[model samples]
Target: METSKVIHAIYTDDDVLMAAVKKVKANKYHIGEIYTPFPVHGLDKAMGLAPTRLAITAFLYGCVGLIVATVMMNYIMIEDWPQDIGGKPSFSYIENMPAFVPIMFELTVFFSAHLMVITFYLRSRMWPFKDAENPDPRTTDDHFLMEIPVSGNEKELHDLLVETGAVEVNLVNNTH
Candidate 1:
């Protein structure tokens, strides 16, 4: 496969990085990725990224958890073996729903949290024992790295990044 050229621009401060992102977008340059030590609020919006649909997926997962809890409880307490507790016989699901509320709530939270984490990992190509893909180690601590594909106009792009307050700039040949 052919290798592609890219530019890595390092910024010391997130404020500068955020401004640079906006300038890059205004200039119509395509940004490959950005690595930051911590979450930078509004960076996604400045990068023009699409809104995440993770909330919708979490809701669906919560619903699945609720259904599973309901079925399991009904099977165990009513269908398999009915028992009297607190003077109420476990012969119906509706009458016993109040008691199962805590179980359903717990399961819903558990499924939503676990499934959301798994989904994020899968979508980001991150898994246990996976090698890190960060181009610069400093980006994981104090610096922010912004990657931009080079489409022959390397000088212009480099100059733009420098003007945008990049602390350092390096040209890289990226091989996927």
Candidate 2:
């Protein structure tokens, strides 16, 4: 199996990392990955990443929750134990909807928040008990790491990275 080389460019400050990301994109070098201690503002834009679809999924999940809440409430209140309470008819789901509105809203928010998180974990391939994929440990603390594939152009990439104020640059064998 052939092994490819990747350059790990370490940056101390987020501002310098942002500049490096933009410069690398302008030079048409594809960035493999980046690790930061915290979320960097506009890093996705700098890397030209597409907007996430999490919001769409969250909306869909919320709809599902609403449906589930409606059906469950209908079954429990109207079909199973229909009664008149407080001079109001409980036999009809529509007439009793006001009481269920709070429940439906709560379920919607609950489902959206929880399912969105689960979807993110699944999409990111972040399984339970999985080992961390970060190359440098410092990236989880104070440093930021940008990984760029070395496609027979290590010298030029290294120079550009250094010029971009990379604190350390390393060429490491990466096997897929």
Candidate 3:
């Protein structure tokens, strides 16, 4: 079985890459992937990708963290070790609840940060101990790369890529 081959075109400027992407999208050519050093405004719309739902996930995780912190602190300080030692009273739920606010806030932030990071990594198919899958290393620095799988005519695709402002184009075959 033969899988689709990927051809990457590297561009020096983001504007040029964006124009190329827009042209390809307008031409109804399928764009396999795009890579840039930083976020490109309007790239998602050009690529027809749906809006990210990461913020919603973070909010849900924060709620979970808050509940966990509240329950754990309430049970431990009020139910399990109910005793008044400092004369200020420790068994009162209101008194100890205020003290738990700091822990609750910390856990909320911790869960949101860690879980959001993990979510992003997994969504992007990235993880620890995994080799980076980059077509061109320069795309991580000062270049923008577009990987398009050629389907019909190679010459037309190459011509379209060149005319749209690609600095260099190269084909990489993965045959086993």
For each candidate in turn, the TM-score is: 0.97, 0.96, 0.89
Clashing pairs in 2: none
Best prediction by TM-score: 1
| Worst 10-residue lDDT window, candidate 3 | 167-176
Model 1 spans > 4 angstroms off: none
lDDT of each: 0.95, 0.95, 0.85
Evaluated at residue 45, the lDDT of candidate 2 is 92
Candidate 2 residues lying further than 4 Å off, grouped into runs, are none
Q: For candidate 1, which ten residues in a row score worst on lDDT?
A: 82-91
lDDT of 3: 0.85
- Candidate 2 C-alpha lDDT tens digits along 60-133: 99999999999999999999988788888786899889999999999999999999999999999998999888
Ranking by lDDT: 1, 2, 3
In terms of TM-score, how similar is model 2 to the real structure?
0.96
Residues 40-155 of candidate 1 have per-residue lDDT tens digits of: 99999999999999899999999999999999999999999989988999879999999999999999999999999999999889999999988899988999999999988899
The superposed Cα distance between candidate 2 and the true structure at residue 15, in angstroms, equals 0.6
lDDT of model 3 at position 117: 93
Error in Å for residue 135 of model 2:
0.5
